[model samples]
Target: MAHIVVLSGAGISAESGLPTFRDVGGLWKQYSVHDLASPGGWERNPQLVLEFYNTRRQQAREAQPNAAHTALAALESQHRVTIITQNIDDLHERAGSSNVVHLHGEIMKARSSVDESYLVEMNDQDIALGDLCPQGKQMRPHVVWFGEMVPMLESAADIVATADVLLVVGTSLQVYPAAGLVDCARPNCPITVIDPGEDVKVKGATIIRKTACAGVPEWIASLKL
Candidate 1:
C-alpha cells in the first residue's frame, strides 16, 4: 500500500465550527490570541492563558468532525494514512484516523511544568489555575506556544519524507516548522493542496480550490480510494 501523509491545519476544524486562530471577530476581536498563546504571555498572566485555552477546549469538545475529516479517515482502508496536524483539537482522531501526530500538542491534554513527560488527558475540558500534575507542579496547556520549539517537527518531517503521496489540507502553509514539513517530501512524491483560498504556492502540487468539507470528499471519490 502507498504511504499517504496528510498535513491538516485549523481550516479543517473551522469547517466543524471551531474558530480559526487568525480570523478576526468574536473573542479574537476582543483579545489577540497571540497574547494568550505564548510562554511570555503565560508567565505574565497564567490565568488568562488558562482561561483562553479552556474556552477553546470547550468549543472543540462541542464540535463534530466534518466531511473532510471523515473522508481522510476512510482513505486508510485503501492506503496507509498518517496525519500530521498543526491543530490542537482531536477532530482527526474522533473521525477515526488511527495514525495522527499533533505537531501543536493537544488541547485535551495538560503537562507538568517541571517534567515534560508528565502528561494527563483533559478530556477536552478545562485546566484550572491550581491544577497540578503528579509532580506537584502547576499544569500547563500541552500546546506548542509561539516562540516555543515544536518537538514533533522532526518526526513529522520523517513521515513526510517517506510518503508516496502527500495531502495538504486547510492550512495556508504559513506557520513555521510545521509549514516547512512539505519540503521534506521525496522529490517525485505527488502533492495535493485542498483549500478554498486562491493560488496556493506549493510548487508542482495539484490545487483543489474548495473548502475542506467539499473538496476532500470529492477528491477521495475521484480517486476511488
Candidate 2:
C-alpha cells in the first residue's frame, strides 16, 4: 500500500471547534506565550501553568472530530496513513487514525518533571499542583513547552522522507521544525496542501485553498483510492 504521510496543525483541530493560537479570541489573546507556555513561566508560577493546561485539556476533551479528521482516518483502509501533528489533542486518534506522531506531545497525558519517560494518561482530569509522579516529583502536562526540544522531530522527518504522498493540512507552515518537515519529502513525491487561509508558497505543491473540512474530502474523492 502507498504511504500517505499527513502533516497537520491547529487549523484542522479548529474545524472541530478548537481554536488555533493565532485565531481571534484564541489563547494567545488571553495569555502571553512566555507566561504560560515556557519552562521559565512554570518555574515562576506552577499553579497558573497547571490551571491553563487543565482548561485546555478540558476544551480538548469536549471537542469532537470533524470531517477532515475522519477523512484522514479513512485513508488507512487504502494506504499506510501516518499522521504527524503539532496539535496536542487526540482528535486524530479519536477519529480512528491508527498511526499518529505528536511532535508537540499530548495534552491528555502528564509526565514527571524529572523523568520524561514516566508518563501517565490523564483523560479529562485536571493536573493540579499536588499531582505527584511515581518518583515523588510533581507531574506536569506532557506537552512540549515553547523552548523544549521536540523529541519526535527525527521520527517525523524520517516518515516524511518515505512518504509516497505528502499532505500538509491546516498549518500555515510558519512554525519551525514542524514547518520544515515538508522539505524532507522526497523530491519526486506528490505534495498537496489544503487550507482555507491565504495562498501558501510551497514549491511544486498542489495547494487547495479551502478549509480542511471542505478540501480533505474533496481531495480524497479525486484520488479514487
Candidate 3:
C-alpha cells in the first residue's frame, strides 16, 4: 500500500468554521499575535493568555470537520496515511483520521508551565488561572507558541522522508522547519500541493489551484484505490 503523508495548515481548518488568522473580523483581529501566542505575552499577562485560548478552544469545539478532512480520513482505509498538521484543532480526528502528528500541539489539552511532560486533557472546558499541574506550576495551553521550539519537527521530518506520496494542503510554504519538510521527501516522491492562493508555491510540486474543500475530494477520486 502507498504510504501517503499529508502536511496541512490553518487554511484547511478555515473551512470548518475556524477562521484563519488572516480572516477579517475574526477573533484574531481583536488580539495581537504576540499577546495571544508568545512566551513574552504569557509572562506579561497569563490571565489574558488563558482567556484567549479558552475562547479559541470553545470555537474549535464548535467547528465541524470539513469535506477535505473527511476525504483524508477515508484515504487511510486504502493507504497508510499520516497527517502532519500545523493546526491545533481536532477536526482531523473528528473526521476519523487514526494517525495524526500535530506539529503545533493540541488545543484540547493543557500542560504544566514548567514541565512539558506533564499534560492534561480538557475537553469542552476552560483552563482557569488557578489551574495548576502536578508540578505546582500554572497550567498553560498545550501549544507551541512563538519563540518556542517545535517539539514534533524532527519526528515530522522523519515521517515525511518515508512518504511514497506527499500531499501539501492549505499551507503557504512560509513557515520554517515545517515548510522545509518538503525537502525531506524522497527525490522522486510524488508531491502535490492543494491551495488556491497564487503566491503559494513549492518547487516541483503539482499545484492544484483550488481550496482544500474542493480540491481534496477531487484528488481522492483520482486515486487508483
Candidate 4:
C-alpha cells in the first residue's frame, strides 16, 4: 500500500468551529501572545494559562470532525495514512485515522511540570491549577508552548521522507520546524496542497486552492489510489 502523509494545521480544525491561534483578533478582543500562549504567560500567571487552555479543551471536545477530517480518514482503506499535525486536538483520532503524530503535543493530556516523561491522558477533563501527577508535582497541559522544543519533529520528518503521497492542508507553511517537514519528502513523491489562501512557496507541490472541508474530498476522489 502507498504511504500517504498529511501535514495539517489549525485551518483544518477551524472548519469545525475551533478558533485558530492567529485569528482570535476580532471575536473576543485581542490579547498579546505573551499573555496567552507563551511560557512567560504561564510563569506570570498559571491560573490564566490554565483557564485559557481549559476553554480551548472544552471547545475541542464539543467540536466535531468535518469533511476534511473524514476524507483523510477515508484514505486509510486504500493507503497507509500517517497524519502529522500541528494541531493539539484529538479530532483526527476521533475521526478514526489510525496513525496520527501530534507535533505540538495534545490538549487532552497532562504531564508533570517537572518531568516531561510523566505524561497522562486527560480524557476531556481540564487541567486545573492544582491537579497533580503521580509524582505529586503539579500537572501542566501537555501542549508545546511557544518556546518549547517539538519532540515529534524528527519522527514527522521521517514519515514525510517515506511518503508515497503527501498532502499539505490548512497550513500556510509559516511555522518553523514543523513547516519544514515538507522539505524532507522524497523529491519525486507527489505533493498536493489544499488551502484557500494564496499560493505558498513550497517547492515541488501542486497547489489546490480551496478550503479543507470542500477541497480534500474532491482531491481524494480524483486520485487513483
- Model 4: which residue pairs collide? none
Residues 52-117 of candidate 2 have per-residue lDDT tens digits of 888788889999999999999998888899999999999999999999999999999999999999
TM-score, cand. 2 vs. native: 0.96
Q: Write the per-residue lDDT of candidate 3 for residues 1-225, one digit (tens) a residue.
A: 899999999999998889765552455578788987899999999998898888888889999999999999999889999999999999999999999999999999999999999999898689999999886789999999988999999999999999999999989989887899999999999899999999987889899999999999998887663
Q: Model 1, 1-225: lDDT tens per residue? A: 889899999899999999887662466567665688888888888998888888888888999999999999999999999999999999999999999999999999999977878898988458999998886889998998888889999989999999998999999998887889999999999899999998568999999999999999888787633
What is the TM-score (0 to 1) of candidate 4? 0.95
Candidate 3: C-alpha lDDT: 0.91
lDDT of 4 by residue, 106-148 (tens): 9988889889999888785788888987878788889899988
**TM-scores, all models, native as reference:** 0.95, 0.96, 0.96, 0.95
Residue 25, candidate 3: how far off, in angstroms? 4.4
Candidate 3 — which residues are off by over 4 angstroms? Answer: 22-30
Cand. 1 TM to true fold? 0.95
